[model samples]
Target: MSTTPRDRIGLVLSGDVLEIGPGSRPFTVAPGANVQYADRAVEGGRDQNWPELIGQPAGVQAHYDLNLDTDGLAPFRSGSLDGVVASHVLEHVANPLEVIAEFGRALRFGGKLLLVVPDRHQTFDAPRRATPFSTVLTKHREKTTEVDEASIRDFCQAIYGQPPIHPTEVREWHNPAMLDADRLALHRRRSIHVHVWSPEEFASLIVCSLLEGITAWRLESMYFSDHFPARTADEFALVLEKVPFANPNELGRQFVDAWCNSVLDDTAIDPVRLARFEEALRRDCADAAINSLPLQLFAAKHAALGMASTQDRITSLEVELKTTQIRAAEAIAQGKALELSTSWKVTAPLRALRRLFR
Candidate 1:
């Protein structure tokens, strides 16, 4: 029998599953299945009816105070959960990979991890650049705690930075007069969209993270929606499977090698485009390698060469300056000589006689 998106998701989600940030519109799992909801703020708290309060659909009531931003879903036992659903919740978190690893830790072997995040190009974040995978890696490695300030600024500035042209646009600019400290505190306390990504790039991030030992979740299936009939689709969904290999070193290497090979596989089908792609990759790889050099080391190597060029530039400038000074002096001397010449003497006497008559 054909199943709906909810049905498809529910099929694999059974037995001790958890859903993160299931605001007012939680995914339909089973009629009376054991599904625990988690969120930072729930109804009747300081941020009472928080999700609904913010004009969002408040899904299931939060039974656990699990915060994915600072406190990941790490309280759960390793390999204890059957599934995890984090729908449209990752973009608000500070460290995506940390939570991702926690998801893997919570799920049993072959358990499912459902994730959904906004597509920057299709959402209110259209004005911003996609978060680079390299930056993602750095944040993940560092276990970043605070919201990326730049991302918060970008978010606030993009939607509310400019004056509204139409009724549908933003109503007011984001606290233009507020101090930096106040602004950061507000964003930190509230939900902030921290990362932006395309579906393909997001998928690649998951895969690359696994390949690089940054995370243990394996991509199972992925989907992108344009939210058709609407201007843009806001979110992309993906599924991950938990693996239990003690040493994934070989597995990770194989995955990366196969992926690289697959990138080249397109050449057989689309030689023209593939050729250009390959050439671009070569150029980019070389640039990346050169750019990876230590800043100080690179500077030290080039210091002597730079000094030599600077000396040559100074010498060239001195010659030009001398030539200009000489020309100026010669012109001044010519002017002086002309002032005392016969033509000047005759003109000066005639001028004096005319002035006296006036």
Candidate 2:
């Protein structure tokens, strides 16, 4: 149906809309117009699909597996949608660049691509280092679909050391399930944070991607959360505008080159450092039996129960101490009152006479 003024409340909500990983509450731009919530699954059965994060169903128009969809938004005809919103969903995908490119492909010219990505510095991924654009490009160029052992080990090492208080659907990591040799299989079964980034790194990544012909989405506005969210805030939001790239101008070339250089300059990884990281991962992965779920869960429960019992004991002791003090005070007051009584002085003379007669 054609969008009318009554259908769209705002200027941006004029046509078809697609929200990837909308979870429970989807972003609604056009109230009466077609809006689709594209999720990996309806139920939280998929390993990577966090039904909890997305929450329960909320009138979601459509559901599809992002893993099987493979092409990201390519299944949708080019220039079909007016906008796409993927909130904190890109970190879980194996190929974020492809997903971003698909966003550009799916939306019509001037359409918006709104992305919310978690900052590693703020979330449980704090232990992890930001993923470089070169690494991302390699995965994209290699067309790697499934995660490898190295990624599994890296993720296990980072998350196990510092688990997210509110983890996405990948809750299995709360225990030692992530350290097992079969972790690669587990990762394949579910989604995990395959990449990490700060807001600056993310912006530079996008810029580099643009220079590499990954997408035509131009950066319109970027926001880094502050104050209430803090520097370690859970995530940052970005808005990109889909535009045609007929020819590259001098200004555009200079802009992309400068950003790319800045991003790449710091990304020159040291081989020795990387080897050390891998060695550390190996050490962590080797201790899978210790990190197993049942053992960890039992330990947590035991700790909690122990603390509760200790508190109860302390409270009992406090009550006993107060009662003892009250009894001692009462005895002292009774003795003082008897000594001051007039009857006690008269009874003392009679007691002396009785003693003399005896």
Candidate 3:
């Protein structure tokens, strides 16, 4: 059968299926059963028949909110499901690795798992913060408040009129109490931005997680939506195929080793650069301490020195200042004559006075 645009964009399923974190609108997969999982539905009601939108056959049944993750669906444990479609759901899950593992477990060998996640590089509406390791450590030492998951969810609901749901569970690894109210309040001041992954980093993490037995297999290919014309970045889809006979432990170790090596090589810094950074730090510290004296102290010291140096010159100015006073005396005499002419009948009175005086 010809694949539809949604299938090309996401999972192209042919039979029985599972859809994780479907939110409000579950994907439409005709001729198959679709199961969706989410935390909360719209207040008025939940869409029990959301799968009908996918135009499934009349006998096809739809199950909603099975809460599979909380229900203990293990990797490689679920009998073969033909396909799995997870769309815009991974970001809200606390442990995406476990969810992916569950998907791997549920799929039949050669079965496809289609994952769609918002590209952190392109998604701006989401709350995100990226801090360096040093800054993170510093904040930890300072005992700053942090925002937790529940508050974040509440914030999302308040701002976007939607409940905040984490797509991945990895963030929970950083702070498990993110869902709790009291704990959330303690960290509420600091953004609960526990994790934000760039496109490359996200792909690498997924690959590493699968290789590490967090999932039962590896991804066959990952496609980004941002580079749609040339390269997509806003959303990404990963096509994963189940590996029936793989050793979980060995695969995990090898994956970890490779991931570590890649990260080290990519982020490695030279000795010269390190030395220069340390030297710069020391110089900045010294300069900051030296410049820490109060402003008033500097102003007072400058004022005293200036007064001492110019004391004699200021005294000499007192004598010359007396001679400069003549200009003021002449100006005062002109002012008295103008005032008398305006206040009195100056034309007749002043003339009579002048005649009498003469």
- Name the candidate that leads on lDDT: 1
Instruction: Quote each prediction's TM-score.
Output: 0.63, 0.59, 0.44
lDDT string for model 2 (1-358, tens) is 5343211222254477777777655654645656667776524363334444454455454555565227576568999888888877889888888778878888899988878788777777888877877787888898777666666677777766664554554555435554565556655556678888876667657655655556766555444444222243466666677888643232234333333332223323112222222232233222442132133333443454356568999999999999999998999998889878998877988999999999
Give me the runs in candidate 3 sitting further than 4 Å from their true place.
1-6, 9-11, 23-62, 72-77, 125-195, 227-233, 245-358
Output the lDDT of residue 358, model 3.
83
**Which residue ranges in model 2 land beyond 4 Å of their true spot?**
1-13, 28-33, 42-61, 163-178, 227-233, 246-358
List model 1 lDDT by residue over 1-358, tens digit each.
4244433555567788898888777766645657898888623453432232454444566888877757777678888888899988878888887878888888899898888788776777778776666776788888898787777777777767555532331233244454287656666666678888766456556645654566765555544453233433467676777876543444444333333333334332222322332232233223433233233332343453356578999999999999999999999999999998999987997899999999
lDDT for each candidate structure? 0.64, 0.61, 0.48
lDDT of model number 1: 0.64
List the candidate numbers ranked by TM-score, top first: 1, 2, 3
lDDT of 3 by residue, 223-304 (tens): 4453265443467666666766466544433433333333323322121222222232233223432233232333443454
Q: Which is better, 2 or 3, measured by lDDT?
A: 2
For residue 29, what is the lDDT in candidate 2? Answer: 65
Taking all chains together, the TM-score of candidate 3 against the true structure is: 0.44
**Lowest-scoring 10 consecutive residues by lDDT in candidate 2?**
269-278
Off by over 4 Å in 1: 1-7, 30-32, 42-58, 162-173, 176-179, 226-232, 245-358
What is the Cα-based lDDT of residue 151 in candidate 2? 65
